[model samples]
Target: MSFAEQARPIERRTLYDELVERVRGLVVEGALQPGEKIPERELCERFGVSRTPLREALKVLASDGLVQLTPNRGATVARLTVEDLEDVFPVMGALEALAGELACHNITDEQIAEIQDVHRKMVACYEARMLPEYFQLNQRIHELILEAAGNRTLSAQYSSLAQRIRRARFMANASDARWKQAVSEHEEIISALESRNGEALASILKLHLNNKFHSVRKWLISQENGTRKG
Candidate 1:
């Protein structure tokens, strides 16, 4: 290898970053369920890490609103209450609308084509009943729009909120009707971008996020009630 190539920074990930990602995966995949106490010793054993890094990772997760850490009770996965969802969705909707508006003004033909490719792939995933893959691609489509918007501040804020609410993707698995409805929304989103209709895209994006919030909130309420009854 050339000296110049070897000298370049490769963006190394710290042990804490790795641990945080692993724990996040556990929660998102339902291995660490909401409101369930995180077994610190068991997680350390599974990941082959020490207590220090595990605790550090948990702290990060808590800040992201994924894990709730208490003084005496330790950490449990956070339950998404109706109030929390209501609080977040409006912020997300407004950011998404702004992104859509700016994306239409700034997006290049190549960028649009790239997003379209992901859109097609996402549709295929939906057709195959691959919820996880579809969810990831759907997120990628939104990410590309945010990136194309070319506003660093908007992108950063939108992305931080996006990460905090990433688990809401799982709620789409609750019903085929809602899943299909979301796919339909994505269809309009792609069309809006294609036509460079900024206002149309902004409105569509806001409505889509609103619908998603409602769907997830409904499912969470049902689960909460079921737990109460049992």
Candidate 2:
């Protein structure tokens, strides 16, 4: 093969993935919404894609619990129930604890600074009351820690669990007090990582996640009850 041919940029994203993202974005933005039927035809028209790829994406989303598929009723965005949080939280706590432990030993000073930089920006967002931006930075800080943990298997598993709970995380019911408390906890996370205290980081991360689960659970319960009423 020619060098030019070999050097050409590969199309890494599949049509199915692009379609899945389009649908996922709609769900996260509250457009598709929990329990609302996925408008497959409208989506196809919007994306200018055929039903084959769109249906394939729907199946993928169903497996991820972002959407549900019914025999005759078709697809709707999945609701994250309190029960769902109950099942997922313990698993997430374990993964987060594991990541925290690993990261303290493996994280470099430069990497630590990078995470701190994002944390600083996150605090700014919180101060500015820019929730959407704060959520983005919050996810980035967590991702950096997972990366620093240096375990592909742990990162992959943690990432999967993270994806499953992202809707709740993004919609977390953070009262002003809760937001302040979260930022304070993040300060300890940084301190532990900087001091290379693996056990301390693990406990902090696990406990922090435990607190986070309750906040999200409150929101999920309300959402579920609201949906029922509507």
Candidate 3:
């Protein structure tokens, strides 16, 4: 066999993996709300894929806590409750704090500059009240920190848990005051990173995550109460 023929190009992504990401985005971006039935037929038509791959994608989502599967009832979007936040936030907070500390030590000046650029854009999004764009940039900032931490295991673990709460975390900015406070917190985070102050960054990250948990917790409670009243 010729060398060129033997060294065939690798497929970057599988159909199943692509389907999983597309479906995950639908759930994360709130196109598929929590507890809503997974409309298999509609999605299959929309994506021009068959049930087999779609269902397989959903199974991956279920494992990630973004979808729930049942024997008779099929699948539904997994609802993130206050209880769920209570369970996950502390762990996430610790992970984020650790990431902040490690990133301060490990991140290069160029990487820090990159994050600052993204942060500036995020602030502009906040000023414009562009929630969707702000949320995307906000997530990117945290992801960059995780990448700088240089721990594959930590990144994998944090990412898995983050997927479960991405939508709820995005909605935590519903309160204008809380949104302002979060931006202020991000300012502090940038300052600490710029200074390479690991301790300060860790504390700020923990505080930031704690505040977000409270914001989300309050929103979830109000939503549940409103449902009951309705």
**Per-residue lDDT of candidate 3, residues 1-230 (tens digit):** 89998899965986788999999999988999898999999999999988999999999999989999999889999988888989999999999999999999999999999999999999999999999999999999999999999999999889988989887777666678889999999999999999999999999999999998888888888888877632
lDDT of 2 by residue, 1-230 (tens): 99999999997997899988888778766777677889888889999989899999999889877889998888998877788889899998998899999998899999999999999999999899999899889889889999999999998787767777887888875798998899899999999998989999999999889989999988888777776644
Candidates 1 and 2 compared by lDDT, better number: 1
**How are the candidates ranked when ordered by lDDT, highest leading?**
3, 1, 2
Error of 1 at 74 (Å): 1.2
The residue pairs in collision within model 2 are none
Give the whole-model CA lDDT for all candidates, comma-separated: 0.88, 0.87, 0.91
TM-score of each: 0.87, 0.89, 0.89
Specify the highest-lDDT model's number. 3
lDDT of 1 by residue, 60-177 (tens): 9898888999998899998777788788889999999999999999999999999999999999999999988998899899999999999999997887677666776466466888
Stretches of candidate 2 off by over 4 Å are 1-9, 227-230
The C-alpha local distance difference test score for the whole of candidate 2 amounts to: 0.87
In model 3, what lDDT does residue 1 have?
Answer: 89
- Ten residues in sequence with the least summed lDDT for candidate 1: 164-173
Question: Is 1 or 2 the stronger prediction by TM-score?
Answer: 2
